[model samples]
Target: MAITSANQLELLQTAEAVAREKMIDPGLVVEAMEESLARAAKSRYGSEMDIRVSIDRKTGRATFTRVRTVVEEEELENYQSELTVEQAKQYMADPAVGDTYVEEIPPVEMGRIAAQSAKQVILQKVREAERDRQYEEFKDRAGTIINGLVKREEYGNVIVDLGAGEAILRRNEKIGREAYRPNDRIRCYIKDVRREQRGPQIFLSRTAPEFMAELFKMEVPEIYDGIIEIKAVARDPGSRAKIAVISYDGSIDPVGACVGMRGSRVQAVVNELQGEKIDIIPWNEDQPTFLVNALQPAEVSKVVLDDEAGKIEVVVPEEQLSLAIGRRGQNVRLASQLTKLDIDIMTEAEESARRQKEFEARTALFMSTLDLDEFFAQLLVSEGFSSLEEVAYVEIDELLVIDGVDEGTASELQARARDYLEAQAKAALDAAREMGVEENLIAFEGLTPQMVEALAKDDVKTLEDFATCADWELAGGWTTVDGQRVKDDGVLEPFGISLEEAQDMVMTARIVLGWVDPEELASAEEDETADEEDEA
Candidate 1:
């Protein structure tokens, strides 16, 4: 192909055709053509020479040029492309270093080998531009639902064609063992769009909980219009799922709106999910109330929530135990996910038995430690005194409130409890010292002797070690693993240390060790208080 040929307009026409076919900017294709022409010119006119090409956008006229750049004497390296200031006087009267000298050069005729190389360069550039376009188009569409056609199956993975790009639905991301043949229509959630070496990798998921939420958004006009919001969703993909929704408007019922008339809206989502059952529950600001709603078709007699531990215990009638738990613990598991809390469901009789056991344990503690008769210990336990610390430190008025308890009896009871606690603390302190606990840790203001011993047992002997510990490490916490909540035992958890108390104690230790500035802590507290005030 020669630039001097009468078919020069064919270059611009071809660029336009390629750009249109690939849905890319025509200017990109023209730039690729220019690059290929330059590469081809470099091959013909000594590969060392600096060759450049430019084409007129309207006339399709290809212009070839030879460029030489002036440089410093010591910096001149390429003899063909660069020239020193002293040797550049031949090109111009006053040539300066770092200046380019250009002259028009006749375009060369591309041979078979050169034509093939040029074609390859242009194709490479076009492919890169197409990849960039595809990534840009789909990156913003992540976390959304998409409709596509199954292109093929490779190693149990389904490749879906989205018209512009292909997405991979990994086997684990598929709903159950659903199969798809070529050209099968499919809908999936665009979980992610990642730019990789070969191209953009679009990951699609049919089992994502968000996919159910998106489907409901499409089916419910109220949700799409912002009147109703899906608060949470949990799925056992292709088996069963639970969704909690809230309504901003007073007139609209979120659950009813999601269910639609005659179960039409939810049924549509269920069909897409391969007949997965869905429980639509109304969202509540009160966590316990919302949890009650989440465990549907089962009656809950009472709910006991341990907020700090993020755990809830539900008491139901004996007959409702199986219903509340569902088949293979599915119902309670879904409820736990929807509520973001670990739930323990038990029958009313079981709860009663557990309460009785606790009462006996507290009674035994008082009997053994305070030397109290069974009747007095039971009375104290019934009046909500469960620990020696509470008995020793509680107001005299609290003890007087119990029948047959006078000031003399209260004083003796408190004295006995205090003596027992002092003995336990002394023993714990001695044990901690034997384990090499430092004086600074024992003298810390907030930590009790039992807590110090626990810390020493865990190898946190010094104040520095205490300062290095995380709040969760001292107060226990819940971790999400494999979509299930797992318990992490903390050294001070048995001491009934709450997360906030643990945090405060650790920060105090840090300040005492000069590791944290008191002024910064004060400033942070002020800022937090101000934020809370602003929110209120």
Candidate 2:
């Protein structure tokens, strides 16, 4: 082969073009190409059975060559194929049968093949290096918004130039209410950055809910300063968004502050969000009230919470139901998501019906004493003791201990209880007479005239009737002849007996009667007994 001046110039030009295309140093390409050609040449005629072609990158010169082992007999077709050890020793001072001897062959064409293979390897490496570089650049940018130039649209997505790389803005990520033009500057969230065959592929979005949140951060000085915080946010992108905000200082009205004076601040955020409507609600610690406010423009009459279910039923006027639910259920849906509640909306009328049912159920618990004073009825309700049985079974002293009761009332209540029991006993006795137990004795001997007078006021007559009385209802939990507790610190203050004396007398009466329940005795003993003993 002949090396021509024109051929050398052409190869030089080809090397420069290939290096430029692959972004590599032209000198490295030339070195690699020359090394590969030399190895090919050795493969073509080396001791084993073939010869090869070679190239000189610097000189544009090329050749073919064969290599063979020195052998005993030169029986092979070419001298390069084999040589006798004795004969090889003449050409080489120390030649062995297995040793390879290189034989230079006539020149050959290899410049084109070497150049093509070199270009392929260079391009593949360049592509991989580019991918790695791009991945490193964008991975740290996730969760932040970046500005990108609109490059072109492929299929339905817009390819964006992000400085050193490109990102894809899919149709779903685009603000549906807005359009983009070529070369337009746009802000998009770096939703994700992933490695791909071409390079690091970035996914961008303009309609993510965080888009509005980011815009708020950018617009609000208070938010940036951390004086106000965004508790939660929900969006119907391209249409509306709801954000619950809280201020660390009570002096700051979170909603008003976020909205800015006359809507200036919020409008700026809205503009950035492509005019998406923003409702800034003040965050509340009270869940019911917070939820009520989250469904704004709708006045809430009440919020009923079912703690076990984490559900809230809100009662609003009929007119506000639509407002509460929003357009196409967007308002309530966002409210539920923002507050993490399953919200049910009801009208005032419906709530009234439910409350009435509760009241009726409470009323049904009383047996015969439904005609009690309305104030007493309200007291029962306030104490959360809504049933007659609860008031009936409570002891007189315990009833007086309730928040609003007093001792004097508790004593009067005890007397009434005795009378009511006596009435029941009489009724039972009548039933017994019609059936049988008429032999039972009625004993008023131990009772004082004052005690008898107190029961007579309520119309009590018999012991059988007294046994059926509810002490708490009659005594109001405080027993008093005047306006004092019957037993003040285990003593009768009027009689000047320490608690010990009252205890002894009551025990004496219980032992003497053998049938008296001490708690049922009106007094330890009548004053007449003391008067008679003093006279004796």
Candidate 3:
């Protein structure tokens, strides 16, 4: 091969052109080419020799050099890279140890094999640069909508060409029943961007709730302008969806603005989603009010919320039960997800029956436990007395508020309630003692006589047993019968023992019994030290 004056600049021009096409810096391409040339030159010069190649940025003329360090006679370990001072003096006068010597070597004509290797190296570097550029561009664009052309499909996943890079629309992320042909325009949400061994992988989704929210933002001017904000969204993908919106300006209706004039705005979104139905509702700060709004078109007669349990009981008219529950419970399920609370739907008749049963149970409890007659028990139940504990704990004035119950009668009823509770406690204490419950466990703070008895009944009579009880076991656990797990409200349900209280009791028991082993104790001490250091 012969080098021509005109061809000397071809390498630089080619590198610049490739860098522009691949969206990379030309300097990086030149560096990669230099590395490839150095590797090829090492084949002609000895492999042990320290060889380097540098390409002139202005002329594109490559120069090859062999490097060696002048060393003392005894310090010359590698003959190729290190030269004895006597050998260095042959090349130059006053050569000293640590002095570097460079010998110009003729450029080797790149042969067929070497050219192939260089081509591979340049292609690999270009691919890596492209991947890095794509990662930098798309990493922050996640959670936003991206438009692309449908390039092809592999298995069930669709490959989308986003102009700068290719993205994957996984099967699970695609809208159900939606189909696409080659070159068809597709819109999706950028779910994730990850760097893998091959290259950067861009994951797109059409089924995410955020996709719906973004679509709304694009279609609704009020949302885009910040007059209305999207609070939450729940989707049943490609079939039905619900979005909760609120307006900062009271004069503006958030739901109406999202729905648009003549339903055109929402309809546009619907058309894009292939006719997926959407329900836009105004959001409310009050949880019950928000829940009622979330369950749209189905009137809720009453809502009972249990905040501690994160559950809501909704009572609606008999005819509205199916409507509120939707087909296969879609409406209630979406409402539960949107509100982030468990929802139980019941008809008004069912709620009335439940209330009646509860009233009878309370009346029976009062009659048997307090030894009150049917008339007195019914009066107490009507006054909202549900348990012996409530009756015993209520103030005398509260009991006196009952009709025909004067001070004397109220005092007597309270006395009987207290007596019943005392007897129950004494009986539990006696049983716990007989069952061999430890005295220290009984004296532990936060453990009631009833808890002691319960522990004894479950063979948790010793201090070690109590210390070893997990929080779930102390608070409540599903009963196991006949080798099958059976769901129970919990053995401690009647005692109203909270999980936090159970945890405190367990910790106290462990500390008193010295149940913590040396390793755990050391770890706990280390954690405490770290916390103290942080505070300081």
Candidate 4:
């Protein structure tokens, strides 16, 4: 083999010099160079042959070799045509029929191929090293804020140059109202950094509520020192925001402190948000008041909650309702998001109507009990019964016994027992009228008259027979008995009935014979109501 010339020596020297300067291992550079040689050879010579190259690190000399398999086919090119067994003998002393031989080829002209290969290998190594450096630099910056220059905007996203790398401030991450220009000094919360073939990819956001929260901590001393805590924050980026705050010290006003003197503290935050309104509401233990405060500057008169609906109905003045609801519902919408309450804002009129319905319901319960005698009456007055139904149906007679109600007083309690039965009788007659009872049938009995008079004597307790009686008898049955005008027990005697029996009889009679039958009464009443409605 001939010794290499100074030009080859110079190439080796140049390769080693480039390796040292780029801080890449000389072995890696050599391996890359060999890979390039193989690729170029494959492209030029095809797969029918194989070529190999090696660089000796110590001497900086390059060597070339060729390989071919032992073959039985006489037609094969390399072995059959060139290396005869006598020639191959110099390569292998023990060469056999199936064994192959190797021969080193002297260095060939590879100037163009090696130069191109070296250029590509250098580029690849440089890329790999740059990638490794970026991975190490940005890996520790996740979940934190990093300073970067606004390099430029690309496709609506701002590219930030973090001295060691670049990050993207995507359109979504940039606060909508904040603008960015090249070289603008801005602080963004570094959300994450990831590795890709290109380099370390960092993502930044200025719109994250956490970003605002972090900035507040910087501006508010209490927050930094841990004296004040931000319990929750809700925001409509570029419009309004609500922050709920609490303080450990009882004397500190959480809202006031966050607002700063003359609005200085919160103004800094507002400026950051481009004049978006900020409401610093004090955190509350009571949900009602907390909700009230959440919809600030729009006075809340009352809040009606429907927990099952996960909703709250807030009543403010007619004027304030709009404010409470906010423009395009943004105010209440943010409040609802913050509090997780489906808020419904209402005006004073709606609240008043709600209260009136509630009042009527309560009044009905009280009105249904107002009529009893002295003992029963006073018992009711004492026990909250203000109606006749209470006296008539006092289930616990022991209540009367409790207040020293004696035998005669107790017996007097039954006076209206007949009157109640009589009233029930009149209600049936009215119901009959509604059922299209002939006016003549109602007047035919003057249906309630005889029953009322007989009840006065405690002789007739109901309207069953009165409902059965001819109208002439009903109108005249209350004849004077021994100068006192009264319907005689004789009137009910015709039915072989006692006073209690008379009362029940009247109900049954009114149900049956009073004109229209009882079953259709409700529909009849509804029809009458409809007819009246039509007439009106």
Candidate 5:
């Protein structure tokens, strides 16, 4: 095709049509055309001749030019694209080393091959621009619901056609075995929007907890407004779900508002979820109170919380145990997800037996360690003295508070407990030394003789070993594996060392061993303080 033979204004018209069809800027289409034309010009001229093209925005007249950069004699590498100062002097009166010399050139009359190449370039650029437009339009819409037509299904994954672009709802993200036919209307949450080599990929989800939250937001005006808020949501996809909500306006009950006047709001969400049963509970700041509320339809006799482990124990009546746990532990699992805590539910009878077992264990420990009879050891255990260390170090007045325990009897108990502890410590110290424990570690503050022995057994015999250990390695923590909390045993965990205390001890060891710069720590601490103050 002859470039000059065609109507010049056709360039602008074509650009406008492509831009409108692709929903992109017309200027971008013009730029792509200019680039394609330049490539064709380079093919006609020398490929290394530095050819460039510019089309006038209004007239659509294509202007081609060759650019040659001025450089020093030693730096002139590309003879076709660059020129030395001496060579450029003929083009300019006074050419500098960095100046470029652009000269006008005739436009190429593209052949069939060149024209096809240009067409390919234009299509590629238009596709890219379209993908970018689709991504920009849908990125901010994530976490919200959108309606689309089901385009097709690929390996159980449904592809939905939004008016602007296509989105994918993976099989695992669909609510149970929900199937869709071509052109069927479907609503989904925009889970994510990602840019890929082919185009922007919009991921849709129907089983996400956020999907339920968004559905409620659309159905409940109070949630859409600032009057009520959805605090947490847990779902079993098509089977069942739970949602906790709170209200800012005291007059508006959050759960009741969400439930609606005739169960309309919650029912709407339930219908969308394929008849998934929902348990709506009120949000509470107190975790125990919240758990009690979360485990609805079953009365909780007692609640015990282990804050450090992020676990809770719930005691219910014998008859209510199965109801509390729900079908196949689904109820408790959803409650655990909602509260962000691991729950162990048992009957009130089981709880009483467990308490009795613990009391017996403590009583036996006191009887064997302090050389006291059953009655006296039980008395000490009943007084809340669980360990020999507590009995040895507690104030004399606390021991005197126990029945039939005067100052003399308290002194005798203290002497026995200390003697036993000291003897145990001596034996542990000997064992640690036998295991290559160093004096530096023994002299280190905070760690007891038994702790040292434990560290030695764990291969942390030197102060350097302690400094190199991670906080979680020295203080036990819970790990979630396959959605179950597993206990990680730490060397110092038996001594009741917390994560914070382990961190402090490690930092102190590092400082004492000259492994850490105290001044740098101080500087970092000051920076953190400044950041907190600024946030406040």
Candidate 6:
């Protein structure tokens, strides 16, 4: 049936109504209609023809046309979509390349099947428009709190109705021991918004630390006003949580402000979180002081930091040990998370015992390695001499500063230290050769005798193995294991070679072995060219 003027007006009204109901642009609905009509026309006018359709926004009048671009004879690619300038001259007096020509085609009568196909097209477009609107609306709202009703439960996950759309609260993100029935009103943090195959997925979470921080913001006026800022949060959800807060105004106590008068503000947050305990602590610029504060109520006797290893050792009184560690190590675990440091907690007695053991081990090492008496070894250990390398590198004056040590004795000790190290190196080299290490690798500039032995033990006995070793294997960066990058001990660490020297040695070995090829040279040339172009 042909769509008459009367039906065309009805079509426009229907599109407007659908757009209003679906919250999509009316223009998009009209475009969908035009595309549907064009697809239907292709059945009558040959699929190879470049057919198109357009609908007037106000009148709902649809137009069908054949479209082609005028191109030079040599530039023509498709006969249906492009026309030569001479061929296009029939449609327009003067036709040139890049000129578009549109010829109108009479409206075709629509059959029942064609009308149904058109309706399906319109429905799909409206669905896509709705999905796009939902994605745009919620994508920027991530990291914010949203109120919704629990619509239903799927498996262990909760489906939330957010008025405009639906969201999902995954099972792992729900607070422990918390359950909701249908129509229960709940507030959750929007963790993420993703566009999936089905539709936009808005992920909600009740156990994110940021969710707790946001709840505090709602409860504490000072926090909302920026007078108090939540610096960091760590949560063992539904059990306990700690928040570090700092105050911009000195007069305003950040913790007290968050606590509110009579603990009302914090209590509100606790109530919302199903009676979870909250500890609000003051933030400190110094890390050790901050860590001390983070582990509150448990007294700390001392804090020893290993900055290079990114770890902290905290010692507490024996009585406070269990309190500091908490049940199953929860307290120290939360403290580590809050401070972003690896923490090791011990009692004062344990720390003292460990220190004494280390001292004895170092003394024994000095005595046996340098052939010194127990008294002399004790003296060297007390003066902070832990290894033979330190003894060999220290100035003679430094050794003379030790008690009962004079100039002659210091010189003899230094000579003995040097001779011992030389003999040790020779022994390592002999062992490496016995293990069948390549002569070329043994002669490498940066590979000390001990390093050769280590490599040989690992079966990296050939120059090819040395050349193919990753930078981390040689100079120590990181290595991928099970798809995660972990710190590499490096072959050089045992040999006492600096990472810089290892890197230089690796480069020199690769050049000497000719591992680099012409492809690598070409890549280098391309990089230089790109740099010059960027500079120009």
Model 2 misplaced stretches (Cα beyond 4 Å): 1-110, 249-253, 357-536
TM-score: model 3 vs. ground truth: 0.86
Using TM-score, give the best candidate's number. Answer: 5
Per-residue lDDT tens digits for candidate 4, residues 1-536, read 12276555654666677677765556666666565655455445553546666767666566655665544446347642245445566777855555665456655444676557656865786567656767777788776777789999999899999887788999988777678899998788888888887777889987777777887898999999999998888888878899999999999989999999999999998897778788898888877788998998789999888653356888999988888888999888778867777677889998889766755544453344334334444444555544444556675474365476665655455454546656767776665554444444345332354334443343333344355554323222345468444543344344334444544445456775556566687788799999999999
Candidate 3 lDDT over residue span 1-536, tens digit each = 32346677998999999999999889889888888888788876777888898999999888889999998887778898889888988897899888989998888877889888888988888888889999999999998999999999998999999999999999999898988889999999999999999999999999999999999999999999999999999999999999999999989989889988999999999998889999998899999999999999899999999875567899999999999999899999999989988788999999999999999899999999878898999999999888888888898889888899998988888888989999998999899999889898788777778988988888988788878878777665455599444544544556887677777777777877776565787799799999999999
Candidate 4: regions farther than 4 A off: 1-110, 132-136, 192-200, 249-252, 306-308, 355-536
Report, for every candidate in turn, its global Cα lDDT versus the true structure. Answer: 0.93, 0.68, 0.88, 0.68, 0.93, 0.88
| Global local distance difference test of model 2 | 0.68
lDDT of 1 by residue, 1-536 (tens): 89864767889999999999999999999999898999999999989999999999998999999999999989989999999888889887799988898999999899999899989988999999999999999999999999999999999899999999999999999987699999999999999999997999999999999999999999999999999999999999999999999999999989889988999998999898999999999999999999999999898999999998789999999999999999999999899989989898888888899999999999999999988889989999999998999999999999999999999999999999899999999999999999999999999998899989999989999999999999999999988899777899999999888899999999998898898999998999999999999999
Candidate 3: deviation at residue 202, Å?
0.9
For each of the candidates, give the backbone clash count.
Answer: 0, 32, 0, 13, 0, 0
**Model 5 lDDT per residue over 63-120, tens place:** 9999999999999899999999999989898999899999998888898888888998
In order of appearance, the predictions have TM-scores of 0.94, 0.52, 0.86, 0.51, 0.97, 0.84
Ranking by TM-score: 5, 1, 3, 6, 2, 4
**Root-mean-square deviation (CA) per prediction:** 2.4, 24.9, 5.1, 24.5, 1.5, 4.8
lDDT at position 69, candidate 6:
93
At residue 155, candidate 1 shows an lDDT of 96
Query: Who is ahead in TM-score, 1 or 6?
Result: 1
Tell me the tens digit of each residue's lDDT in model 2 across 1-536: 23356676565566677667655566655554454554445443354445654556667655556666765564544564676787677668888767877767754344666446545655565566556767887899887889989999877799999877899999988888667789999898888998876678899988787777777888888888999999999888888889999999889888888898889999988887778888889889999989988999778988898653457899999888888888899998889878977788889988889876766556443323544465665555555665444565667777786666798776665555556656755665565444322232223343433333334444444455333434332232224577333422211222233334434544444445455655555454556678789999
